[model samples]
Structures are given as structure tokens and as C-alpha cells.
Target: MKQRLGAALAWLEDRTGLVGIVRTVMQHPVPPGATWWYVFGSATLLAFLVQVVTGVVLGSMYVPAPDDAYRSLEFITNDAPAGRLVRGMHAWTATAMIVLIGIHALQVFLFGSYKYPREVNWMTGVLLLAFTLAMAFTGQILRFDNNGVWSTIVLVKMTSYVPVIGDDLGRFFLAGDVVNASTLSHFFTFHVFVIPGLIFAIIGIHLYLVIRNGISEPPEAGRPVDPATYRAWYHDYLRREGVPFWPDAIWRDALFGVLLVVGLLVLAGVIGPPEVGAPPSPANLDTNPRPDWYFIWLFAALALLPPGIEFYFLILGSGLFFIGLFILPLLANRGERSWKMRPWAVGIVCVIVTGVGALTVYGLQAPWSPDFATQPLSAEVVGATTGPVANGAQLFHEKGCHYCHRIAGSGGQRGPDLTTIGDKLSENELIWRIANGGVNMPSFAGTLTQHELREIVAFLQSRRSAPAPAQNVPTVR
Candidate 1:
């Protein structure tokens, strides 16, 4: 039996040369010091494989039509066999892939691995990052829920901020002048087919480059890259101390990849998928749509940017950022590779990570959005139980004023807290502001009656701090 099996294997190898190819790849030499930092790239590839597997399962069950997409998702979550777990795995793995790819990019940048012959590798990585994010955005819209619908609209509107081709771009994304039946199908095609195809192609090229150029060695403080001599030096260096990739360096990548997969599975089983929101409804005025966590930083930035320069910042800023990423190796590919000698690189990474982290936290709180779920202030908190003050307090919530303005710490922080407005503004001033409105506040002139206006003003006027105790004065001798 052993002789027969060996003969069959030899026959296959002779016909295809498959054994030699595998042996060559597995026995490829890499820098001996290439440690756990090198594992992230392979780990990211593992995460992407998980995404592909789970996404295929989901795509098989999800309906691409707008009318049925939400219902299909509900069915998959509640009724299908192990559907929820698979869906959770898909979502969590997408998150993991983004995080891993980001870390891998940062590692390469910090190590100066993008220098010399590896410039194409970095450029391919940038394309993968862009495509990964594009996949995420398109996937969010496939939920077809209230938040998803509104998010699509918001994205379309933002696209409309571009100069000459803005409207055309918006129309193209929507598949028409407005989001309709075709919109879901368009995004579904992008999420499941188009973006994934692009990613797969780029990933193939990236891997080819890695094998062709060889992995970069761990940076030494005194070593600086010189393009003219880098290839020869790298080959000689590898010849001196390099180790086979399979049994030596590949073990760390394999171990980390397994752990990452197990962690994602545990998370998926424990947490399940994000809850599906209400079905899409244009009439749902109270909806406060937000992007998923990965995109919240950009959302916060757009919300916080000054109105005058927002358009320029959105268009020019994003374009320049991506352009800069592609041209980075060209700018300074021969610099000192060690972080110890590149303080500016460390500072740039620190600033970017800090800024994104802070923005994400702020976006989660979303102080700028109206709090539609805010309850009416209780009579005790309002300091009134009857008459115009009490009635006005009730009206405050009924009229949706509490949604944006905080009074007794029970409302949103979008507008100014009006807890002590009476102390700052006169009755006339309050009336004018409320009647005509200012800035983000809407006009209540036609909405409120004269009696209601007076009642609200009376309620505002009653909100004052307690008077301070009288102080004793010193007498002159």
C-alpha cells in the first residue's frame, strides 16, 4: 500500500511539478529576526478568508431587493439554522479584518518596509485598505433598515458636495436620481462581488511581491536604506542568517492566525450579530442614523467641521490623504528605517491614532444629534405641579424642544443647556429667540400660539438659581 501511494504521488508530481513548487515556496528564506510583528499581515489574510466564507453564506440567504431585504434578514436571524452565528461571524470578522489590516499597514510604515523594491507592495496595501472600507460601507447599506436607509441618503448627499460631477456620482450610487428598488441591488453587487474581486486581485499581487522581494529585516538604529545597494545587501544578509519560512518564521503567523480565528468565533457565539433596526421608512423623522464604529471617526469629523470649509475639507482632504498614501514610498524611501531615528514617524502615528480614538468616542456619544427618546421632565424636577409653569414644562417635551435642548440634565446636549436661561435672558429676549429661532434651532413662530408662548416663557423665567445670603459690610473707624 505504501509503494502504491508513493507511485501515485510521484506520478502527480512528475506531471504538474506541484511538489517542487510547494517545496520552493515553503523553503524560501526569510530574515531570522522577523518576529511576531510580521504575523499581522498573515493574520489579516486569515481574517479576510473568514469574511469571504461567512459572507458567502450570508449572501446566499439575503435578498437584494429593498422591499424584502429587511424581512430576509429577520428570517435569517430568527428562523434559519445557525444563521445568527454565521451572520455574527461575518460582521465580527469584517471588523477584525479592518483592524488587522490597519495594524499591518502601520507596522510596515513604522518598520520602513515600504522602501526600495517594495514600493508596489505598499501601494497594493493602500488599495486593499480602500477596498476593505468600501466593502464595509456597502455592507452597512445591505442591512436595509432605518439607519441603513438614512445612512445611504446621507452618503449620497455628501457625495453631492463635490464640484462638477457631484450629482452624477450620487445618481450613479443610487442607480437613479433617488434611492429606489435598484439602490439595494447596486450596493449588494458592490459588497458581494465588485469590491471583493478587486481585493482578491490586489491581494494576489501583494503576495507575489512579498515572495519576489523577500521580507524586510528588523530595523537597526544605525542602518539606513540606500536603494542602489539595498537589494545586494539584503540578499547577502539573508544568505548569512536567513531561516526557512515554513518551520521557523511561519509558526508565529500560524499560531496567531489560529488564535485570531478562535477569538472571532468565541465573540460571535457569545455576542451574536448586531440587532436589526426598524424597517426603512422615510416618514420616520425621529431616526438618528449613524455609521458603524469603523466609520464613526469620519462621521464625527464631518459633523464637527466648520460649515464654510467642510466641502473643501471633505473633497480635497480625503483625496490628498489617499494620494499621499500612494506616493509615500516615492517621497522618502531611503530614510533611516528605525523608529528611534524617525521621531516624526512616531509622532504622526501617535497623532493619527489619538485623533481617531477621540473622534470615535465623541461620535458614539453623538451630542450633536437630537435625543428623540428623551422623556418629559417630572413635575418635581420642573419645580412646578400646576399652572403655566407646569403646563409649559409638559409642552416642552410635547413640542420636541427637549430633544435638542437640555433643561434639567434630562435632554440632549445638541443645543445649549437652558437650565438657567431665565438668569441670562429677559422674557422679551427668550420670546424672540424661541419665536424666530437661531442657528440650529427651528422657528416656533407659526407653531406656538400666543398663550403657549407666554406659558413657555413663564417656565423659562422660573428657572433661576437661589439668591445668595446677604454679606456683612465692614464699618469705617
Candidate 2:
């Protein structure tokens, strides 16, 4: 039976030349000293495969309608056997793919692989990156949770800032001017099918370019890439000292790929997926919707930007980023490949990574998140017995002051802590700040009644480091 099967396979191979094609791909030449750094691209590809398989499994059970989507996901997460694991794998792998792709791109940039013959490869890779992010964004909306819907609302608002045809694009995104049944369906279609399809096609082209151009030789100190002579030189260099990609370079990639998949599985089993918050509720003013971790930096950027210039940052910043990436290969396509010779490149990378890291940390803390969890100021913390001081503490929470101001380590950090606020300001100063807001704070003059304002101010005056007699404040009648 084995002999017969082997003979049949040989016959099929002879007819189709599939074996020859596999052999050719396996034996493709790679430059000498191709080390663990080369494994990142393969790892990224492995992550993409994980995402595809897991996403398909998840899609089978996921409902795309706004009404049933959250419930269906809850069912999958709690009722279906192994469904949580599958969903976790998909979510984790999406993040892993984005991170791996970023590292791969950074590797390419640092090694100067985008120069000369590999320009198109880099361009395809950038597009793939964009498509991967698009998939992530659309996938977020499929969750049908408050965070997801709010993210879409934020996205639509941002889209509406585009210079030309902004309204049309925004309307198209929201599926008829608002997030409804059609909105969820639109995102579901793009997430599971359209963006992934584009990624698949672009991956094919990216691989074709990689094979045609050959992997860039590890950067040398002084061997600057000259477009005219580099190709012939690389060919000659490979002929002299190249190894078959299958056994020599592929072993590291295989080891890394296996470890990555295993790690993802372990993470899925341990951490599982992000919590699916309450179903979409546009009217929920308390919702502090945030994107998944990879986008937290951008979310932080939007949050921390000066209030009115959000559109400028959304448009001009994004425009400059893509423009810079597109023009990179054209600007310095033939130059020194060594990072040692490129201080400006190193500086740019440092700045971007540092900025993103800082922003992500801030986003995680989310100081701007409403302090709905803030407990009312206790009498002990307030050091007050009665009168306006006690009423003021109640007014403090009632007026949403706790949402922005921290008090005795209980409230938010958006505004200055009022734990020892009495040490910093007089009653008049407190009243002034409350009546006239500064920067991100909202003024309460139009919103608060005179008695209410006095009560709030009385509460602020009582927040002291030590117990003290309440000041004899005149009653605001």
C-alpha cells in the first residue's frame, strides 16, 4: 500500500511539477550569516496565519447584527467548548502580528533593505501594515460592545475632519449617518473578508518581491548601496557564499515560529481575550471607551492633544506619516546601509518609539476616564463635622468634581489632587477656580447654583492635612 501511494504521488508530481516548485522555493539562496534577525519576517507571517485560522473559526460563531452580536459573543465565550481559547488566540495573534510586522519593518529600515532593488517590497509591506491595522479597527467594532461603538463614533468624528469629501466618508463609515444595524454589518464584512483579502493578496506580492530581489545582505560598514552595481555585486556575492534557505536559514525561523505559536497558545489559555463590555449604548455618558492596546498610543494622542486641533493632528499628522514613509525609498534609496552612518535615522526611530511608549502608558492609566468609581468623601477625610462642609462633600461628587480631581487618593488624576488643597488655596481662590474653569476643566458658573457653588467650595476648604476647625464662612443665601 505504501509503495503504491508513493508511486501515485510520483505520477502526480511528474504531471504537475508541484514537487519541483516546492524544491525550488525550499532551496532559494540566502546570504551568509542570516541569523535570528531574519526570523522576524517569518514570525510575522506565522502570526498572520494564526490570525486567519482563528478569525475564521470565530467568524463561524460570531453574529454581526447589533442586537445579537454581544449575546452571541457571550455565548461563544461562555457556552461553546474551546470557544474562548479560539477567540483569545485570534485577539492575541492580531496584536502579535501587528507587533511582529512593526519589528520586521524596523529591521528592514535599520538594515536598509528598502534601498535599490527592494523598494517595491517595502511599499507592499507598508500597504500590508495599513491593511492589518484596518482589520484590527474593523474587528474592534464587531464586538458590539459600548467600547466598540464608541470607538466607531470617535473614528467617524475623526473621518469627518478630512479636508475633502469628509462628510461623505463619515456617512459611509457610519452606514447612513449613524451606527445602526447596517454599521455593524459593514464592519463585520470588512473585518472578516475585505481587509483580510487585501492582506492576503499583498502578502503574495510582498513575497514575490522578496524572492525576486533576494534578502538584503546584512549591512556592512562601508559598502554603500550603489543602485547600478549593487544587484550584480549581490549576485556574485551570493554565488560565492550563499546557503540553501531550507536548512540553513529556515531552521531559526522554524524554531522561532513554533515558539511564537506555543507562546500565543499559552497566553490564550492564561489571559484569554479582553472583556466584552456592555452592549453598545450611545447614550451611556459614563462610558470611557478605549481601543485595543496597539492603538492606545493614538488614542492617547487624540485625548491629550489641545482641544480644538484634533482635526489638524488627525489629518496633518497622518498625512505627514504616510508621506514620509512613501518618500523614504525615493529620498535615500542609494546610500550607506549601516545605522552607524545614519544618526538621523536612529534619532527618528528613538523619538517615535519613546513617544509611543509614553503615550501607551498614559492611555493605560487613562486619567481622563471618568471617576465613576470614586467614593464620596468620608467625614474623616474631610475633617468636617457639619454645616456647609459636609454638604459640600456631597456636592463635590454630585457636580462631577471627583471625575477630574483626586481627593485622598480616591478620585481621578486629571486635575490637581484636593487632598491637601486647603494648604494650597484660600476660600476665595477655590471659589474663583470653581467659578472660572481653566484649560480642560469646565466652568460651573452657568451650571451651578450659588448655594451649590458655596457648598462645593465649603467642601474644598475642609480637605486639609490635619483636623481643624471649619472656618466661619458667611452663608450664601
Candidate 3:
């Protein structure tokens, strides 16, 4: 890094009359009036660096299967020694990166730094902000927790507005009825590589443009070079005010970035990523789910809405908002750098910020969810019947209970592991279900004799208290 920094500084100092070089932009030998506030961009760049490195580390450890996902995360957090460190760094850095970007963008916006030649820069920035948030949302759900699942549920429904393609889109995104390995892998690839790749290209483009068009300073005064005569560059300009990009630029970026990483590490050690209440199970239809904080507002918004009107407006509103956001650069490409004259453009930006902020705040505070978490396994859960649950036992095996629920650690996860069924369900609850079946379960009443239901109920619960083996060894002295 030091060698690269040296080479970059040499290259910068060698530029031919590079008037827009960092040193010149500062005004003083150091950008005369430039305040530390200007460092927001530098800080943002640092955070991005953290995201790339940390995300790669996280990707290395993460498992993309929905069923295995919760366990994989647990392993990352609790079992794999470095798993916690890697995941913690990646998760917290991601959050910090977005926030830093937002602060940078907002600072520039408020200061009217994009008034003239910087409009394109600011516009590109806004798009970047959206991308940052997009990655955040996708990464969060890719966790596939009870929260992740339900968050996707609400999101899928919201997307129902993509004409007739909505359902297909949702299915495609989820990789099936619920999030699956495909969803995890897809999101992982996007989060760690694809999106970051695009972001990198954008960063290159954004920086190159910054170089081409001189940095925009506050509305203060300067030699108002007519854009036509301002032969842009700084190689020669270095003799007048330039500093080596080594100790000057790269050093600051690296130092601050390290500080940010250390700070986030401490935070993660203290707080940790919020754990989900439970892993999602489609078989348990009544589970109450919510999304992570970044999305709490959206969840809250969905709650506030009177079902029909709320979704319709949200769909339409979000679509139009994004469309407008993407097209803003072209719309403001008049190429003017006069912040004083760009009230309307600035206003548009403020409007977007305000609207998004208000919605986020509202969504976070609103109370909107099912009245009851798990519908109490409704009395109708299994339905009217008195019978031997032994039939239910046969039904269990026949219906693939063993495929998902485990007597111990043996079974598929197509549903929740049922090793502890007795701890939760009563005999009546078990028997009623055997006779009638509930939720994803098929009714055994019509197929099983009353005695069969009894036997199966007995069979399913019997394993709960299976005896422990006698001790084999004593504690070491």
C-alpha cells in the first residue's frame, strides 16, 4: 500500500498543469478554507473499503441454504471461532458504510456542492445511496430468519404491482415457496460480488468525472475561470499547492478506515447482530414475523395502511419514486454549477430526503401485525374428533413427519423439528390433530381408525422422554 501510494503521489505531482488537483481544491497550500467537514467523502471511501473486505470474509463462511441458514449463522456467531468476528465485522461495517455515504451525500446537498459542475456528481451519488440501501435490504433478508421470511412475505405482496409478473418475480427471488438455498446463494453472490462490482465501476466513473470536472467549492469566491478557458488538471499545479497523494490521501483513508473498523468491532462485541426470535417454518402458518431495523419503517408503513389502499399506494409510490430518482441526472444535466441558481434542483433533493425520512420514521413506530402470533393452534386446528393418535403416527411417517420433525436429531427440516412436541402440545391437541390434522398436516380422521390415532399420538410423544444412557466416565481431577 505504501509503495502504491508513493507511485500515485509521483504520478499526481507529475500531472501537466492539473489545476483541479486536491491541493489546489483546498485553496490554502492545503485547500485554504477546506474544513474537516470535507472529509465526509474520505470517511465514506473508508467505509466502502471495509464493506468489500468484510463482505468477502462473510461470504467465505456463510451457508446459503434457507433451512441450514439459521444454523449456519449460529455457527458463525457461536461455534466457528472466527465466524463471529468475520460476520460481526461485515454486518456492522455494512451499516456504517451506508450511513457514512448518506452523511456525505447530505452534507454535499446541504452545502449546495452540486450546484453547477457537480450536479452529475451529486446525481451519481444519490443513485449510489439507493444501491447501498438496496444491498442492505437484500442482505438482511438473505438471512432467512423468521423475520427475513415474513419481511419477504410483505415485500412479495408489495411487488404484486409488477402487473401479472409479480408472483413469478417473488417466486424467482425466493427460489420457491419459502426462501431456499437458491435464495441464499443468489443473495450472497449479489451482496458480495455482483453489486459490489457494479459499485466499483460506478466509483471509478464517479472519480474519473470528478477529475475531469474541477471540484465544486462552497459559494465563496475564486478566479471565475470561464469553463471554456479553465484548462483542467494539476500536474504543474502541484508545484504551487499539491501534496503527495501518499502521506496526504492514501494515509488518511487507511488510518481513518482502520479506526472505523476497530470502533465497529468493539460495538459488535458489545451488542452483536440482533438474533431472530425463531427460524421460519412455513408449516407453522401462525408465526408472527417482523423485519430488521433498517426495514422496520417499511414494515410499519405496511401496518398503518388500510390493507387495499395501503398496498396500492405504496406500490405505485415506490415505483414512481425510484423511476424519478434514476432519471434525475439526465433531468439536471444542464451542466450549471451555480448553487445559488439551483433552488429547484436542491429542493427536489430535500423533498426526497424528507419523504423517505418521514416514511421510515412512520413505518418504524406503527403497530401493525396479526392480532395473535400463532393462532393458538385453533380448536379447529385438528377439528372435531376423538380417536387413537396411533393412526396419526402412521400418518406422520406416511405424510413425512420424520422427513422434517426429529425425534432427536434425525429428520428433514421441511418443517420445524418436532422432538419437543409433548413440551408444547397437550394430549387433546395431539389427538385432535391426529383425527383432523392442522395447518400443513393432512387429516387422519378419515383414514385412521380411532385406535390408530391413540397409538400414533403415543408413539410421537414417547420419544420425548427417551431415557438417557448411564454415565460412562467421571470428571478429571
**What are the C-alpha RMSDs, in order, of all predicted structures?**
11.1, 9.5, 13.7
Worst 10 residues of 2 by lDDT: 280-289
Report lDDT (Cα) of residue 206, candidate 3. 77
Please report how far candidate 1 places residue 110 from its true position, in Å: 0.3
Count clashing residue pairs per candidate: 0, 0, 36
Residue pairs with clashing backbones, model 2:
none
Q: Compared with the true structure, what per-residue lDDT tens digits does model 2 show for residues 1-477?
A: 999998987998999998777888889898989868888998988999888888888889988987789888898888889999999899899889889999998989988889998998988888887888888888888997766766776677677778798879988987875567888899998888788888889999999888889999899889999999999999999899999988988999999999999999999989998888766431342655667888788878877887669767877888789778866898889989988998888898999899999999998996565656777777887656687878888888877888778988888776667887876788787876676443335445546788888888777766667655545443545
Worst 10 residues of 1 by lDDT: 468-477
Q: Give the alpha carbon lDDT tens digit for every residue of 1-477 in model 3.
A: 999997787777788546445555444222223455566677776777777776766666777776677777887789877667767777787778777887787667556565445567876777777778878877887677666655555665667557789869867665664445666676767777777888888887777666655444444433332334433422234346555444554455566667877899897777776664466543443444555566666655665567457777888888887677556545643334444565775687788678667878886654423222122122232221344333444555654455445545555543455766755566676775455332223334445556556666655553344332335111111
* Alpha-carbon lDDT, every model: 0.82, 0.81, 0.60
Angstrom error at residue 295, model 1: 0.7
lDDT of 2: 0.81
> lDDT winner among the candidates?
1
Q: What residue pairs clash in candidate 1, if any at all?
A: none
lDDT score for residue 133 of model 3: 83
> What is the TM-score (0 to 1) of candidate 3?
0.64
Best-to-worst ranking by TM-score: 1, 2, 3
Q: Candidate 2 — number of clashing residue pairs?
A: 0
